[model samples]
Target: MADPTTPPEPNESVSETEIEAPRSRRRGILVAAVVAVVLIGLGVWWHSTYSEDTDDAQVNGHLIQVSSRIAGHVAKVYVDENQLVKAGDPIVDLDPSDYQVAVENAEAALASAKANAAAARVNVPIITINTGSNLRSADADVTGARATVAQAEEQLDAAKARVEQAEANNVKAQSDLERYKPLVEKDVISKQQFDAAVAAAASSKAALADSRASEQAAEDAIRVARERETQAQAMQKYAQTAPQQIAAQDAKAKQAEAQVEQAQAQLDQAKLNLGYTKIVAPADGIVTRKSVEIDQNVSSGQNLMTLVSLQDLWITANFKETQLRRMQAGQAVVVHIDSTGKDYSGRITQIGGATGSVLSLFPPENATGNYVKVVQRVPVRVDFTNLAKEDPNHQLRPGLSVEPKVRVK
Candidate 1:
């Protein structure tokens, strides 16, 4: 072999132009590197103009509190701390005996009211029937009385004429008897004729007395009929109050119906209270901060536990006032979750009306003599656009640190 570590032999045909070929290749490489740097610089400048990013952000979501709606002694606690539960799931069971008793009482009261209403309604028909019968009977009595009076008046007139005729006949018969007596004494007439005349005169006198008695009876009958008519008229006036009596019964029915309605409302309220004895979850969430236990006496609206929702969440980014110049709602954003080392696509959904400082418990007053101007940060809410794809397992929670980048252009 040739000498070890010796240079290889060169060809004689190679010239300066060929030798400068390597330099030219190196020069091209330098130019390419410079071009790449310039391109990268332009790209960074362009991205800076359109992209607004901030690390002052946090994952935010709803933190619901579980409370008791009714006062009762807890019979059982179904959920513990950090237990996941679905909506309408029972969290606690209170003793429902008292509420059940109230419901039963309400139902009994409603039944009683309805029964009273039915009874009142029944009275209306009965009063109407009785009153109507009284009116009809009274009207018939008045008609009958008037007819009797008319018949009595006609009889009285006939009797008076008969009495006058009887009196005239009696007077004629007496005159004939007296004349016969004188003629008999003078033997001008027979004795039998005089006796006949005397008998006729006595019969006429008896007929006249009977006619007068008949006339008196007719007058008494008329007076009796008139008295009956007056009584019937008075009875008719009393019967005319039938409609008013029916109206009074109707009023009683209405009052009973109103009571029934009131009782129905009470029953509904009792049912609601009974339902409250079972404390059910208002929404799907993870239970935490459990402050209630079995047999605990809880009041209405008292906090029993805390519920945190993990399914729906968003990033709250507090961007500087200067950085919010081109920020707006509905703009695309990128959210970076450091806890999971995940990047998710998002969009700006809301912008706070006031700065964080202004929303604090004690806001700053710039009118103080000794004041220093400070930049304020505004809260921007960014919601996930591809929520399911990025956080399918719901790993994000409220108060978690996150980085959000909002696109300005």
Candidate 2:
């Protein structure tokens, strides 16, 4: 040390090399800082050009509502909240006693209708045969009556001819008897001859009377045969309705068959109702918000619970409209879940047709003229490609916050 407080000479101690070394160090530091800034800008530009990222993303999945198809009292509950179930698994069961009884009643009704149809069908042919037989018998009776009338007319004609001959013979016998009487009075004829002549005339007169009676009987027979013919014709007309009777019977059979079909339909409906009493899961999902309980009376179409499908999950990333210029379907994506702190690989499937705000319950009215321009966010759907392998534990759920990056290059 030269002195406690000594001031150094202005240009005696400092070397030119030392001064240049410090200046060089400062220049090197400035150059390094400039290069670092340039590199940082280039990195940022490259990342932005290659990929699009958004923090406004969430896991989305299918939300299924479970309900009852028919009205019944709940008999049993098979699941609790947050229980995983497979498709067709039993979720709830209603009292099936009423449905079973209805099915039984429908079956009985169907059987009865079938029996009635069978009986009606049997009557069709029976009626047809009986009517045909009646018709044939009536036709025969009419023909026979016509033939009997013709025979009676012929007999009447013959009887008339015999009466005429008998009259002629009586006339001749009377003339002969008159002549004999005159001769006997003149004492030129015998009494025996006169008696014989009188006998012959009487017999001829009796024969004429018999012929007249036979003619009357023949006429009466003809009248009776005509009456019989008219009656037979009436019967034939009545029996000719065989087709109508058969058609009526067939119609009845068809009606019974229709009833049978109706009863069968009712039976099928009853069976379906009985099957509906057992409520099963429509898909594989996690049961949540279970609102049904045992012994609860529920009505048709009543909501029972909610089922969340975790296996088929996708990411709904809301990105700025400007970022969608290069974003499109079939692009690779990476999703980072906030809950699991893990990244999942996925692919872009679709983009929403409209902005989320536009699809809201109350859309913005731009026509008010006082509207303020806002950068809208469009929803992009990114479906996980290997969620089954990446999230086997099923930690990711719907509405979970996630960060997704989509590669547009």
Candidate 3:
């Protein structure tokens, strides 16, 4: 104010503290900037040390393919595409008429086989008893015939002795007659003595003839007894075969029983085939890719539909090799599903054995002369914990992108 555009005189009463105030303020600002930078660096390092996150993750679930077990014409289709179905629910039906008829045929065969078996079994005991009785009767007949033969032989011997004695008496009587005849001729003996000697010879001759007849009868009796003994032996032999015949009958019965069993097994198989006509869901899932329809002729092992199990879902997190240095199984994970915009708690269950590129259908070969270095990604399976309670409707499915953060510490 004293002079315009003229330099003013410096004030000497101002303290050094006041003079250095601006520098102090600048120094304070610089210190604050440095401290802030250090705190930010620490926060970033801590976050990196405790957690690893990746957006290259997807929800994975079981994909089941449903097929027909037998060949048949479809009668009904019960499910459509994307239909929710429970385990053991009837999903399709095939023509069961043929199988039912087969079952009926098998049952009829089984009944017939059982009847045959029963008849065979009944024959076993009856034949056994008849054969056993025949054997006993034949044995008794043989014993009786043996006794008769022995008695006849003794009678024959006694008759032979009697004949010899009669012959000897006849010879003596004849000799006496000859002597008497000579005496009569000589007039030294009476005619009466000669007549008596002749009568005695005739009587001895008759007795000899009778003994001869008795001997012949005894021989005939012996022959008859021997014939009877042979016949009895034949009968006894026939009786001895009863056990073999019984064994044969038992074998027949067993064969019939085996046939019955075979028929029953066929019946059971037919019933199983009939039951197979009704196709049921193997598990709880959402149906998809359903190619079956009503009145379609499907063959065995034909794919009928596909089912996706939304329950028990997991996230397949593909992390870069560098990021996997801090990842491991049993670590806590936070999964955020992009579809539902929801967060789910999970834990790492397993790490893939091979990298994504190595597991690819066309794996890269480094020896191809134009090889380029590239980072590889490894898949880690993260299974949801309490998935049902978190999302009761089973909203998660396979192939849906998700973000997962794994707390390695």
Candidate 4:
């Protein structure tokens, strides 16, 4: 053996260039790997610095509950589950026969009330005219009766004067007759003179009787005139109530008008009830959770269906509290829907006022001194900016999972 520790002799086929080629190839691969890693690190840092992403997001929309406003037996159901409907489209129909009858009855009542009011109004003027005429006539009668009583009083005074004159003449004639009787007994004068005295006395007595009769007749006339005056006064007292009667009539007319108004109100209410029998859609949406059926008896405010409005939809993203440092309203957002594998453009509308755990039914209490820190999530509302353009078919529904990315920078 030549030297045990010495190297063996080199072969001529293995050149020095071949030995150096392995080292050069290894160096090229190592340099390329280092460059690739550096580029990837820079790209990741840029993404993290400029944007925020969260998978705790979902699509949300308005879920309107459709119900009956009045109690009735359902006669028709116009929509099925998942059916699209426009605002004011008929959704259900209740039996309208009862409402129709109510409307008819109300109309009849209103007509009756109107007729009564008309009659009462006509009576108002008539009563006023009649009462005014009666009052005027009574006043005229009272005046006339007073004049007749005055005339009767004057006649009574003249009759008394005539009675007094007649009595005086009768006394004088009787004295003369007594003197003639004495002369005739003594035969000192002619009998004709005594006879003349007797005739004068008789005539005077008859005149006195006639005067007394006239006085009695005058008293009777005065009594009759006074009675007429009393009658006239009574008539005036009755006519004095004419104004009160007219007012009462007017009041009756007003009451009738009030009744007419009440009837009109009732008729309007009946018409409204009739309109309520036809249930219509409140907005444009897709019907779901249909619980009403034909011939089913539904009470007032009973749930008939649920209407999901896809036209007004948004995303609710639960973001970590740490991610909200650079987030704010009106920031641009990209929503990736997991169900549809589609991306929608939106903008941040609002951020929650409190964390999800604090808003929960049972919030955690850390005051017991055994506190463990937790990462809390805050709800963020993102409203689509291009919903009409991207989702024309309205396929995005509520409660769909989504991933949202916000460009915070």
Cα lDDT, all candidates: 0.90, 0.94, 0.92, 0.93
lDDT of 1 by residue, 194-281 (tens): 7888899888889889988998998998899889889988988888888988898889989999999999999999999999999888
Residue 149, model 3, lDDT: 96
- lDDT for predicted candidate 4 compared with the true structure: 0.93
TM-scores, all candidates, are 0.69, 0.74, 0.73, 0.70
Which ranges in model 2 have alpha carbons more than 4 Å from their true place?
1-17, 117-261
Total backbone collisions for each predicted model: 0, 0, 0, 0
Poorest stretch of ten by lDDT in candidate 1: 6-15
lDDT of 2 by residue, 1-409 (tens): 5984665675435666678989999999999999999999999898789999999999999999999999999999999999999999999999999999999999999999999999999999999999999999999999999999999999999999998998999899989988888899988888888889899989998998999999999999999999999999999998998999899999999999999999999999999999999999998889998999999999999999999987689999999999999999999999999999999999999999999999999998877678677999999999999998998888888999999999999
**Candidate 2 — worst ten consecutive residues by lDDT sum?**
4-13
lDDT of 4 by residue, 57-124 (tens): 99999999999988899999999999999989999999999989999999999999999999999999
Ten-residue segment with the worst summed lDDT in candidate 3? 6-15
User: Model 4: what TM-score?
Assistant: 0.70
The residue-by-residue lDDT of candidate 3 on 1-409, one tens digit each, is: 3766655445433555677999999999999999999999999998788988989889888898999989999999999999999999999999999999999999999999999999999999999999999999999999999999999999999999998998898889878888888798998887787778889988988999999999999999999999999999999999999999999999999999999999999999999999999999988899999999998999999999999977668889999998888788899999999999999999999999999999999998777688677989999999988898999987778999999999988
For candidate 3, the per-residue lDDT at 234 reads: 96
TM-score of 1: 0.69
Model 1 stretches with alpha carbons more than 4 Å out: 1-39, 138-238, 369-371
